[model samples]
Target: MTDKTIRHIGAPASGRSTRERLNPARLLSWVSGYETLVLLGVLIVVFTLTSDRFLTADNLQNVALVQAVTATMTLAVLMPLIIGEFDLSVGYLIGFLVMLEAVVAQHTSNPGIIIAAGPVVGLLVGLVNGLLTVYFKISSFIATLGVGILLSGATQGISNGKVIFENIPSSVTTLASEDFLGLSLAVWLTLLLAVVLFYVLEHTPFGRFWYAIGGSERVAYLAGVRTNRMRMTAFAAAGLIVGFAANFALAQAGSANPGYGPELLLPAYAAAFLGVATYRPGYYNVLGALVAIILLAIGFNGLSLLGVPFWVQPIFNGSVLIIAVLVARQETRQVRTG
Candidate 1:
């Protein structure tokens, strides 16, 4: 072949080399590393345009308040995810803890004791989950699922399928009504936890160890990382976070409802998985989870304002979870291939 024809055969007719067209930077730019953030921005803009109340201060505050519980749970789930484990019982744990708090509140007027019970129960649940999965050789998914079922039954038994409507301590009510800088205390607490968790997950050796374990438990073990301990710690941290979430839930509702906990499960997982596409792309991060929670809260609030049916919220959450999983898998594969 002629030299010109040979060159033509190697290069596109558009005068671009194959390598130039397939450049990683170009591909990544098109994919956008911050897909979740971009989606969130788009949703915000759309909602703002569609609903006059969407951007109002009251509405925004309400979104923050409503999402606080989910955000806390998302943080809990994120820890377990970092260590390559799932805590399916978080939603049920919230129910169990809230019921436990309410039952305690009925008997005691001291808010300190009532509040202190949350973390204790959370730690115990975490310990059980960790031992079951790490030591007993059960899969986290199945172990937590079984644990969650037990929690559900316990919650029903504690509350007797009745919502606690009275004897709620004043402190608990104050937590729900008290506002700081125009936001509810629960919202502020969620933000505070997010900040603390972000720092720990991104800047500490403990966090890195969990990430290492998540990436490859075998490799982490060979490298002298305490894989089992880290995994167990992740579960424990998750349980502790869930305990806090229960406290927030009780404060916000001023009552304990046996059925409310399971409703949070799908949304919490959705937020955590959706977060995988933000900030860190393939890895779970607190900032991403927080952003995801905000996005979901806004989306649901906007829809409700537009008179959408209640069932639609779960549909949206489930769809987001599926999409997030696909995006996370794609990102991970890209990282491996690259």
Candidate 2:
């Protein structure tokens, strides 16, 4: 039979195939392509219906404010991930920078100086991490973990296990509390950074190089990408972004605690992994990360309103991470098999 004749086999005698029109598997495949977005919509609807305050403009603005730090850190995390590396130090690094900012504020009242110091320290730490991984040939996972431990120790030593509640300038607090156009400045800053990252990752050659390296270092190197420099740069960029995030954190909390940074690690990573299931599906992107942060913030906020215990947040976050990773992997498998 001709190809055209075979194609006609599924058609009904009246020129319509009922089976094809009602195929549940095909419907499922189409829906699965936008699973994250669908889930977000469903969550929003569920929360809105179950709680009186969930869909309020005020609550949403609050969610954006609360998630700003996580969104920023997720962006920072994405850089290293793009180059096939992990900066495990990001959690403690935040604590170390916050402590440094507080200590600096105590000695000096200059907001610019206080803010600049955090990024410098972060940059230095990131460079050190990159050097260890790239030049010394150490694994990024191990190197970053060791660096994180050292940072945690240094933070404790410097703070002496005391949270720095004093010497935080009014300007520092204002940075977090100040509102513009019905939202905090921190939220605007996060949005701005997200735009910048979107442009770089989606437009620039530098971003493409990182993806290439992540795909295959040897092949990327053969294709004339600077594998070592790009990897190191990715680490350095992550540090710089983390430093920026630390400032937002300080502004929000109005103080520094030695233990605060490590706690952020799980949530930040969870958001990052969950982000893979958003927007671009198989690849990590800043917009997706921001969406994931918002989704998480909403979920936690709803739970809090429902009187769920504080410990449940971490459990929820961990579970989301595992599910997101599995979904991302399945999407990847489908892409390969399809």
Candidate 3:
């Protein structure tokens, strides 16, 4: 069989205009995923013109470091979205997982132990979510919202409304603080994870199955795709990613507070949603999420340097998410109608 990448190359551009025909799917694969490039360009122009500090290496590094945690969570949230499910619980789950990792490390002084157990807890939580949605026929949004509430409660209960800080060691701190090849460790990990996820979702049979399922689960099931298993596995994988993100945030903050995680959920989902509006246009993909997060990060970072209020970040994210989703929906509708 031809590789899944060729298949996901998607329908030919077939635009009515000559310009569109020049960049058909078969013609410009090398430059096809250039959404990131455009966003980067915007970043350059805006930062260079608006914020004096934005062009500095130190400011750039700070942006990368701060964005790393949100980018990680964005990728985690992308898993269920690919399968046409939304995971609202990721924010709340991160809170609990962050606290849980810190608490465990504090008691045991073993980062390895906490890291190992974090995903297991995430998996169990994901399983509960999947069971409720797939088996019990609950809407994914509602189910995940409920899970998020429960997770937040559990996190608060565990931390007793207090931040946990003293237990963090240098080892755990290195995960976020250390630089790899001059890039933040968190950003490096995000890049590596993106490549892995892209390969899995674009080149493998499972990747094709996810596309099929996302297109229409009933049809995919009829075509012999294991929709139930696929959904469950996707949710589980999302949970695992969220757990890792939780750890990254905890390490970065040098403290675990149940409040930190959910604040990021909006930007996380915004990045994922904005991703679908580019490159593949109507479909969600790994590179899209990465690019979207970078765009959002650059925009927010630049604004902050310009003395914009901190609350404006959410306004930007919320506005962008709505616009991105609307654009994606319109593209889908146009394709179907045309």
Clashing pairs in 1: none
User: Candidate 3 residues 1-338, lDDT tens each?
Assistant: 11322113455556557766565654544344354456568667978898788898887787787777788888888889988998899989988998998889778887788776667888888888888889999999999999999989999998999999987877887888888877867778778888998889878998889888888999999999999999988888888888878777877888997686788787787788888866666678887788787778788888888888889877877776776667566655654575
Better of 1 and 2 by TM-score: 2
lDDT of 2 by residue, 58-93 (tens): 988877777778888899999998778898999999
- The predicted structure with the larger lDDT, 2 or 3, is 2
Clashes of 2: 0
Off by over 4 Å in 3: 1-40, 309-315, 334-338
Per residue, candidate 1 scores C-alpha lDDT tens digits across 54-150 of: 8898888777777778889889999999888899999899999999999999999999889889888998899899999999999999999999999
Give TM per candidate.
Answer: 0.88, 0.90, 0.86
The models' CA-based lDDT, in order, is 0.83, 0.83, 0.80
